[model samples]
Target: MKNSKEWYKLDAFAKTYSSIISEGRTTCFRLSVLLSEEIDTDLLKKTALFLEQKYPFYNSELKKGIFWNYLQHKRNGFSVELENTYPCTDVKRENPLKIIYFRKKISLEIAHFLTDGIGASDFFIDLIEKYLEMKYFKREVNEREVGNNEETNNLKYKYEMEKSSKNEKISEYSDLYSKYMKRVNKEKTVKHAFHIPLKILEKGQYYVTTGEISIEDIKRESRKYNTTVGKYLLAVYFKILLDKYPQIKKQIVIGVPVDLRKIFSEKTYRNFFINITPSIDPSLGSYTLEEIIKYVNNYFKIKITKKEFYKSIYKAINPMRNIFIKSVPYLIKRIFFPFIFDYYGERGYTTGVSNLGILKLNRKYSKYIKGFRFLPPPSKRCKIKMGIISDESKVYLSFGNLTANHEIEKEYFTYLRRRGIKSKISTNY
Candidate 1:
């Protein structure tokens, strides 16, 4: 196959995010696979090289242009390397994405500009499938299931862009803008939510702690609460926060990223998700777990409707559509956008929780795979974030923290244990 020298423009979401990224502060997401055995560096390298040929988009490098940043196909071949530092600390023009393997773990760290978790997971699954085949069977996996060429590879992007651009309704846009304005007008100026007090670590340093619990037990608890797993978990997160910081009597808002692939029919490996922040105000009164679950369930029901979801998307994209905003020079937009994001964007939400849903693998490859963990990007304001991934039997809750405190994590596991769920903890310090 010949390499095409084609450049793809960043989508609206990516375009907005690319401007705000700085050194040590990035919009990178990590999807890691923990193998049952030690990694074969040579074989893993060969696997990455082969997969890069199949998905050339992963091989693209970021470039700064007159109007916006774009991705151009990398002329030189791609290679996998050993991981040296924490996740997503060095995403820039030199290397926007990377594949790193350390001992039993193989991680794919991609800049958020490239794709969302759904898209990245698709690519990672194919890479793992191909790797297993090459390692054990010594054969090439069939491409018919995935696609033939690069164009077919990015079909999701093509479909989503086409659909998003075509369905422009002025009324819908106005309604979304109105809602955003109403929220901002009455938005309370609250201090950053209390985090477990600990000595701050050096820049780019992160502490990762993971807890494994039985999926069956999680389901049982969720059923008892009459809510979905995601909501139940969010309730638990809020409960722990309240326990740790009882003195603060303000609302605690947690950002939950909803995957748009299910709602929108697009299958693109690019980003297509929106964040919804569900909040609980302790000033109202002490909230029982039942009340928190009820609030979370109602929030999800209202916000996840197609009309509401589309409104949120339009709200996000509406700024880019303005003629005046679009007319601003790139340099000014670069400086102004990050400030807007820092003050209005990051401050609104206390923390973020992303549930990647369950991972399905063929039985043959399942034995070689132990499980999966997701590491969220580091944030200065929101010091701790939670990422959830599950296999058939066990659910993995990973906490990616910028602070050195273990108090919050300790309370979380203890709460779970009190509910008759035992947890096994592991950490990368």
Candidate 2:
């Protein structure tokens, strides 16, 4: 163990989670930011230095697989095996941190294994804001929030805040629960990789808005309905799908990712999560909006819990002991993974949902960032991904993909509008 080079931040979740032979590629996103104020080069450098010191991973290596080890073992960023993974280190910090002066806007490309849009967005804003404040106001920054700030509510305080429902237990398993076990064992290579370019649209240009649902209102509605905020939105989409394509609702499957934080008390920096509990729309062909919402709610309730979450982790970790014992050659482990892991994500979900809850900008850049947006990776398998976020006052729903066809997505929005929830839809096709 002498040359182990163990750093506390070495993400065990990313390490262990990546061991499974599925979508070996990590989740990644790019952020483009425009500052309202002038940039401070010196302060920016100081900020990067502070981030490096504070989050030791900034100085690490990605030598081991994206999950195994990092290039700079203690660097403050994602782990990637450079030669193997294309666009591996999207957020290139090779140039001097002072390069902030040369660029008007910077794009931060990050792997999802490290942080979701909300998490990465939080860190990105914090780093820049802290740098500015340190240079101008000479104030210190505290990375981790404690005390009242420790409450998950304050996690994104600058935008808006609302209280979550008290924990509630279900008496019976939901009716929507399916009898089949969901696993990604099949692989199919897509003829063309799905790539969608982000289009920067003028705010409030694309859609008309009517009634607005506030953050408090959404949370309250979710609790009142005995469902989750995510499920509430899904309920909205399900109704949309049912109404728009009334003849096509034969057991439609909608997928939502379950954040493990709700189940585990442990804190780690990695993409360790699970998809929504799968259930068929038994009455899809004949169900009404209210019925669909209720079904989605009940199903979401049964699938998520500390017990089930742990069970998922357990199953993922100790895979095929009987077969793995034969020990595929090391060369096979390296070569066979890409084909196997990718096949897993394809067969894993009929559709995908990534809900990065309310995104509130830090106080430091409160004047700089007007609103936030998140678009997930669009693939042929999961042609559409719904990203939902709340700005304390209103919730934003968006449909993302590389395909230019607007009929499907437009239908989705039209359905939402019909449901009394007002929203703006933007597309970068």
Candidate 3:
């Protein structure tokens, strides 16, 4: 059967990321998988092409529409490469999503325009499962005495076959949201924000640091704090920056991404999350870690609601639908979109906090895997951003730093260490 998932248009968040592609932003995010055994490149390559056909919705490239940018179905073959460069460093302007692999690691460095972490996690896990199955079966065959065995050949045929899926196609998920939620009328803008004053690293360089903490310990701590895991982590981030650099800015804004899929019960593979920046002021006076956690809990309780998400959807779509803005050509938009992106994006936030919840598998193959990591996109303004995800055992707290500031991560993990929630940390500085 032909793929029903046609690439027609770029979704809302896709358009935003696409416009800012030229402004020196990588705009790509990564979802990585670590396995117990080394990845077989040949088997993984076969698995990659097969999965691309099964999930043909992802076989897309960005192209120019008459007025705006659109996604076109790309038939130029899937890209699978060795992990040589920085993670999530792919330019998302015209490139399709890629699969990068090292010895025991496989990562999907995809554009935010392609899909959010939750949506793409399905594909990532499936590819790993399939690759592992194929590798083990081949090993079994090579060890056998027979040259042309019927039973072995039958299993080989099954693995080689490309099966088309009637269900789970991307076309089933609609991009339109006006039918479900009402739009918010207006909201104020942040004129000024606090950016970390750390000296930045040079071009093509990124600092990677990860901490492995027990899920039970972190959950216990969050419970102790009377908050959720995400809010608790956000509070810890706020407290770290405050403790380190308290005298600098009046306001410290942190952008928290709210997954809207759970809100409307829609499972669109495109980007559907909204950012709600919850901030604290140093000018009001210095505050303790507990105070910041309570403030974050209270702020999210009030601001991150179903209704608030709907308003965010409205604000995101309105400018694109504007009569005047719509009339402008793509050339003008290419030049002007960065300002809009910066104003509403990294410019207003001290840093970002995103916890991608848990790492769940469709199949019960967790034994063969080690863990997972969700790497967020980094920008010049938000020099160091955090991405977190967990499994049954431990929570992986990953911070991708673009500056020379090593103390931020040190202080963050050190605090967790003192709280009786010890974190096994690693870095690529």
Candidate 4:
């Protein structure tokens, strides 16, 4: 049977996130691969065409209706062009996702409403593999042997299931509320930590600086502190803030995005992550890097468990289930949703740090690739964001800034070097 044309409804997370999009916040996530040689533009274009057919859902464009915005399959074909503007620009009728070729780099920039990091990574790997096969071997890789061999390309929307027992839900809910109350009662105001000051860009420009470090050295340092790489880097971040702004007496909060796939075991390629803010207060006392790591480690142990994770999922979904909220019209919701988010969402965190984890590829394709780097979306409030990704031998830390200064990057890499981890810095200013 032939597939029929149909419109797909946006998930709860997508609906809430879409309202926050504006010229300032593009809500775009980028995944790019650096090849050993210059990219073949013609071949990349062909591969993109093949990919559009393979993953039809990605080819759809956003549409606004009476009730809400939905995705409608495009009648025309997709296009892959050279990158012309800054990362994470808004998607339109002609182009929903942009594929750009610049020298040896091929990047895929997708709207956050479409999918999360993991989902985008899956698609990106598949596209690279196909492109390589077409470029070198002059053939196609089998669908079954594609990236992860997971059925992430399916268009059918999948959501979290309320599989936990009633007792389990109640227990998790109570625990979550207890934690929330503790934070609220402990600190009355959301502490806005010090941000590195720089001359703001004109309109659509941003800055990107990258550092490559040895994974082995990072692991050794992390093991010495009895913590994971993510926590260790986060600790380093907190230390930098403390050194830069010595007068901040309150807590320093960092927004970390937690992947929900491990908790729900769901394979759908939509947004399925939550932000958890972990902080360390300077008022407590002067502390060393090890102490900061200890604080972060304990926080993760307490908040990252399966039970706590489910509590977050329910908290996000339960409001959407309310009959009253469902009855409200889209215009009213669109008008006020962003204000609610700004008051309760953006002000809580000093900055965002997302670790894309490790990258694995077939031996044949791995040798052709130089490395992988993930650049997070630019922000209006946070000003600077950090993204981490690693290959077999090295880890790449990319600091993306909306302002025009290298002070933060310089201090950060210098700190890593002082700790005996060598780093090489690159930039796109």
The lDDT per prediction is 0.74, 0.45, 0.74, 0.72
Model 3, runs deviating above 4 Å: 1-6, 136-173, 177-183
What's the TM-score of every candidate structure? 0.86, 0.63, 0.88, 0.85
- What tens-digit string does per-residue lDDT give for candidate 2 at 1-429? 012243322233333223332221224444434465555555565566555433433334334433243323332322212122211122332211111232334334455434445445556666656755775577754444211233421333211111111211121111111111234332222222222223422221222112224556567766766777777778766555555554542445565766664564433233445665354443425666567678776766776775555455544443423366225543455555545544644455545667777666656555654344444544445555666655656665556543444555666656645644445443333
* Model 4 lDDT per residue over 1-429, tens place: 022444556666677766677666777878888998899987787777667655656767777666667766676556688878876654554466788778898988888777778778878888898899888887854553232233432322121112112342332111222222211112223546544555666667767889999999999999999999878998998888877866677567788888876765545555667777787777776778988899899988888776676556665556666787777887887888777666666666778898889877777998789887898877776778899988889999999888877788889999999989998888886
In candidate 2, clashing pairs total 23
- Cα displacement (angstroms), candidate 2, residue 379, comes to 3.4
Question: What are the root-mean-square deviations of the candidates from the true structure over C-alphas?
Answer: 5.3, 11.3, 5.6, 6.4
> Which portions of model 1 show Cα errors greater than 4 Å?
1-4, 140-199
In Å, residue 131's CA in model 2 sits off its true spot by 4.3
Name the weakest run of 10 consecutive residues (lDDT summed) in model 1: 170-179
Looking at candidate 2, the ten consecutive residues that score lowest on lDDT are 171-180
Model 4 clash number: 0
**Tens-digit lDDT track of model 1 for 110-219:** 88888777778888887788788778778754454234455654564344334434552321111222223221222233335443445557877878999988999988
Candidate 4: residue 356 lDDT (0-100):
81
Q: How high is the lDDT of residue 283 in model 4?
A: 74
Clashing pairs in 1: 156-268
lDDT of 2: 0.45
TM-score for candidate 3, please give it: 0.88
Winner on lDDT between 2 and 4 is 4
